[model samples]
Target: MRGMTNTLTIGERVAWYRRRRGMSQDVLAGLVGRTVDWLSKVENDRIELDRLSVIKNLADALDVALGDLIAEPSLMEWVADSGTKTIPRLSAALMDYRLITPVSSPSPIAEMPSLVSLAQEVDELWQAYQASRFGYVTTLLPETLSRCQTAVEAYDSDDQVQARRLLAFTYQLAATQMTKIGEVELAWIAADRGLAAARITGDPVAIGSLLRSVAHALLAAGRFREAMQLIQDTASYLDPHLSDPSPELLAVHGTLFLTGSMAAARANDTDTTRTFLKAADESAQRIGQDANHVWTAFGPTNVAIHRVATAGELGNVQVAMDLGPRIDTSALPMERRVRHALEVARAYSSWNRTDDALSTLLAAERIGPEQVRYHFLSRQLVLTWIKRQKGRPSSTLADLAHRLKVLD
Candidate 1:
């Protein structure tokens, strides 16, 4: 009991100094002179920590009273009040009603599902991670992944195409989460299956959507032209007259992923970009512009997040950042939230804002090790920008190359 108590106490102490310093794991590691990987292992209870001297150094660095390091309830408990605080926005039709909308559910958890319910099993998995329930999260992934796999297989045999499409989407969700948590190979395998199902089911939106992610995977490997080509193919494949897709489908394809082609356009035709944008907006309007499914139902906010960074390629960073948060992620079904978070991370990183870049990546990373792919994306942009800024090779860029075990 005492050992358990000590572990809790020490964890609390570690978490406190880290936060008080306003230091990310990487920054703290640099200060106290430890690798970020080691820092992560220590803080996450994956290692036996024995570096009180490091704490003293951190105390001096962050300008905190050293005594505060030993404060109780563990530092993790105060994260909400710590750096992740939500700054409430003023009301406007452009904002999420939830952002401006009063909290009608007195207890936030009132809407939450039990950890075992299928309807919200994906959320439960994410919740486990949010609560620092790493072991629980790990234990649950196989079950969730397996259950989703079984569902996909059953759909394969069943006559219901929509059920198959939904299950295939579920598989894609599981794969993307797995990728964020550092499950790259597994994620690729699952994603391939999901893509196959989308193809077999003839969901054009799903096909284009998978192609979009395929482009991301390619982009991360620095296969820029390949990624561009895939986007081109995807854009070529779309048929405006096609119907039955949710509003979110239009947003993702005609807007979100379509921006990739715009990025590679490089002054070919501003008029074409405008035309594509109009098509996306028109496609979204067909669905009433409601911000459901994480405001991805082709609403203004989702459109902003979708267009912002790519627009930045054409000098629209101010508009992108200003309009980004208005995206009502809360309205999204939980399965989609994880995916959106990864994209949000990418959007922020592309603007040369390292702090926002890291924050966005960490939001996805906090969820698990399988998300290395996103780290690749963010670090690529960040490293490139940093190198260009220095007029010398960035050591930080070199550091990420080492992490990726790739030499560029």
Candidate 2:
């Protein structure tokens, strides 16, 4: 009777085990001789799991014992507060990696869209990312990536050069989205591919932008020293162009410096952090206060936001708090605004201001519920706050935890 009452639905257990093994539905479907769409339906409870043989096959494909699928851990908590679509969609997008290959010969120009059209499509993808419409981005990325890759390989003349630039930026957008969802290895691969495309284009500015994307993935993967070395190596080439840099070049350069500053802060190199932050400040001042570049939001206000983040990472809670209110985040995108609020929440947590931390986190949630609900840091903060409460938590906190799925 206990087992009957406690058993996880086949869909829930299947999804949990699949994610635990880091296998996408595409991969699992191939292993089990099924279509991804079919597997998705099963995982979403659209179909019954009544066939014992099929269940066994799924267990084998997932490399888990069949019994494991019948019963999940009773104590397993922290189910995602948001819809289950995000990670699965990301995984599906990454499956397109196998389709990308080097183009050996150019296709006829008449068969492909113009270079300007391809570039505009890539820019539209970037806009989707900036607006934090990740679901729509997921829908766009596979076709965009395929189209860009084809354009790059198909053009034979000066148009080919521009096509390569567009392709490189498309890959950078993929890397950015991958990194946002904590898929660092996939992000690294995308960034490296973008760098290769940029190098082929022979554009220093594009190469610099791809390098910053690579550095971001490295930092996310906890390779701080490697990330710092990358920034150092690439900065030398790009720094010379600063004298009369285009706004594009300045945005990339400023973003690189800001990334380097954050990496240094994470590595506990305070002096290096300060040096990079100051350099970034100079670049931001030159560029002024706007998200002028389509690919990056690295202007004065954005730089100020990173300074607060850097201070927080360095364990300077009071200092971060002091600087937080001075920076106006209105010019930034929704993603940046939510991140700044989360950083301030982190500082509040560090200072043992539990109520302040909760308030800040709630504000961030209101600003971007999808981001807060899916972010690992937000989950950890809510869990920690709940554990630290004395006796019964306030009704608001209790309701918040339940909504966040930090408590069942």
Candidate 3:
């Protein structure tokens, strides 16, 4: 096992570890709450092992750290090649400010840009973020944050209000990017700052937006109950405007419901998930399809995509796959489309259609390489696929694994 660790798939590693511990497949399976046949498939690399919870359970049953099972040199190489430094830098920035201190002291009053220019810049940054141009966002965030701080300090009261609003939205963008890169703590800080600034601006919509961002961070951190409560409370507070909903109101409202549904799904609360999803669907119906209001992209098509995602999350693979055919990827933005495809790939993997899953993932990569390459789950899928091959993997799969840094 030690000699072949570099070449062995995850299933082989699991079997090796179990055998080294002198445990039969039946014994290990019982400890992990799985049947022997399931264990055999996993050991033979006939099935993909992608779920973190399942991995953790296996690690515990095998008396190993979770990282001991997952850490691989190839994956490290991929991370290095990915150039994903934004999350760490953002985390450092958040730690520097403690989510309380301003980003920086003001420049001289004369050096500050006018509120109009600042607002325009903010719009550009917002557009970049919504377009999923994360590298561009990383390039712009430091200067934009500094400028926003300077404006917040330099402006008079009336103008300062708008300046703070710009600052808040800028921080919200930071939060969104940080979350995408798996920097949950940094994302939380940025979202909190956005909420603070939004409150100062007295804009209910901005507040709602920041709340949604914070809830996202919470969800990523696995605080599903807290996330659900936060979103539900905020949604109720903002419900008054639903009767005469502006696009912004509808977007936020729909997004909040969507977030609530996700949190509930994570908690295995089917009733709550159904209720929130129903409300979101109704909101989407009213808004029609493909609306990118506030970059939430809350509309009928987006709702359909989430339905598939929610079903997948709840372990209803068939339901997720059944709903997948109804989704119109053409109506989604590039980022959303990539995500939908990846979710379908996950469903295929769950259904033991490894070839279909790999094809789906590769297709998504072709459509948006950055989106696919930088995603954490993509590496897992690639590694699992590599392990499942009985002999020499096809050149196509091997080449992708090498490109993705999951194979030597």
Q: Give the winner by TM-score.
A: 3
Estimate candidate 1's alpha-carbon lDDT, on a 0 to 1 scale.
Answer: 0.47
The clash count for each model shown is 16, 0, 0
By TM-score rank, best first, the candidates go 3, 2, 1
**Tens-digit lDDT track of model 3 for 1-408:** 322334455677789899889999999999988999999999886767655446666877998755456543212122223355554555566565523656765356568778898888888877666555666676567677778878887787889998888888888988887777555667888899888999998877788999999998887666678988998899888887778888877888888899888888877777988999999888888887668887787888777888887887778899987888557787667788888888898888888887888898988888766667656567677877766567988998898887765677
Q: After superposition, how far is residue 186 of candidate 1 from its true place, in Å?
A: 4.5
Reference-based TM-score, model 3: 0.82
TM-score of 2: 0.75
Q: Residue 368 in model 1: shift from native, Å?
A: 12
Per residue, candidate 1 scores C-alpha lDDT tens digits across 75-156 of 1111322232111110111132332247743223223222234436665555444433333444445445444434543433
Which scores higher on lDDT, 2 or 3?
3
RMSD of each: 18.0, 12.8, 4.7
Query: lDDT of candidate 2 vs native?
Result: 0.73
